[model samples]
Target: MSIPKRVAERITNRIKQFQSILDAQRARDVSEADTVTLVKDLLSEVFGYDKYAELTSEHSIRGTYCDLAVKIESKLALLIEVKAIGTELRDQHIKQAIDYAANEGCEWVVLTNAVEWRMYHVLFRKPIDKQELAQLNLLTIDTKQDECMERLYLLTREGFVKSALAEYRDRKEATSRFMLAAILLHSGPVQTALRREVRRVSEMLVDPAEIDKILRDEVIKRECIEGEQADAAARRVQRSAEKSIRRASEECEGSEANPNPSESPPVQDAH
Candidate 1:
């Protein structure tokens, strides 16, 4: 059997073998930590990470008893947090795993309740700036059966994790570019207006010339014309404003020399 097929079969058999145990424990009282241990053991056995996987039950410098930790080549690669079957996984759980990842400089975090697993990528922009990037829902052992398991296996696959991490990095870069463009394009009203005017003129100038010519030989010439027109308009406005100001100043000088008799100067009153 191929590796993929064997992996699938192994997972299927594992799920089937554990199904009855899970069903029996549904009504019985059982600790979440125990369930987490079962899952950790299963994963370690199946994935051949037994040597690197460790279950923490005591506080360490990195964190207080992380459910499980996996090391690869002397580097912490994965952190896991386990909850009970009915326990609601919340931001606090994710935050705790994130904190562990930060301390250990790990790249992956997993939050699970034995039945369902969520995988997160630790995105680090710098030594201090670390965050969870994308989360994948791995398994829904209580709900969907085949579909959820397939997705879970896909998440666990080596290629899928690499692709997801790459996509997360790309998405961050694209978001940064969008924010930068927004800042530059909408800095102020004057800047906004200027960009709009420039874009409008560019579009108008380029469209007709390209539409008329096969090779658009006149496109550059048309753009030059549009630019000249804009410059001329600006100069015209400047000239008109200067003329108005000069006229106002001359009128003020004439009024000072020949004061209007009808407009009386008030006499100073004793305070």
Candidate 2:
């Protein structure tokens, strides 16, 4: 999900320059038309879309119009539904865009208000499902953060042309297994392996049932990585924990050297 150095720099600068202004406008209730134009500008400047080509607003499905579409080599890739900047994206909004995608045979549909972008994968299989693959909230994100940019990069024109978003979804699904492994409650392989490790490290023999009980109580701390998001915050938590451990270790060394005087080990009570 890494963007090219040049592309990343451009996006970072654009967000830094425009986010506050956009926020002020959105606070005043910008019109849908204006939001759509902003979305196009984001596509062109941040996502690498050529405004004249590869991006279109005239796309229609069975005479019904989608707000925007991205095409590669004359093939429609995704349909987008734009709402006013302050609009809350709902399931109905997503379904509307998905209906457009399905009718047009487009595999992806996005619903956004220039503030929050949500991407869905349209499954063509029976019992049709619109699975949400990713989402980004521009309002709260720090664009300079690597994890933030990585997710945002998936929606770029180069990303869409190269199927980077799809690849990102696949990678997320695969990595999700590890996250599940960390917190599985069932007697799954992950749980079994963890129990084995616990037994190996325990001072006394540990029972599998004990591990199950402990897990049911959910006493073990775990960090969850959602979708394609990086574990950046988790790393911060780990560093803090390591610092506390080192401080404790240093205190213990000092205590040992000075020998906390409990009257010098009861002073010679035997005397």
Global lDDT scores for all candidate models = 0.55, 0.76
Model 1 score (lDDT): 0.55
Q: Which candidate ranks first by TM-score, i.e. highest?
A: 2
Off by over 4 Å in 2: 177-271
Error of 1 at 202 (Å): 19
Provide the lDDT at 199 for model 1. Answer: 66
Least lDDT summed over 10 consecutive residues: which range in candidate 2?
225-234
Tens-place lDDT per residue, model 2, 77-96, is 87889999988888788777
Best by lDDT: 2
Worst 10 residues of 1 by lDDT: 177-186
The C-alpha RMSD of each candidate to the native structure, in angstroms, is 22.1, 16.2
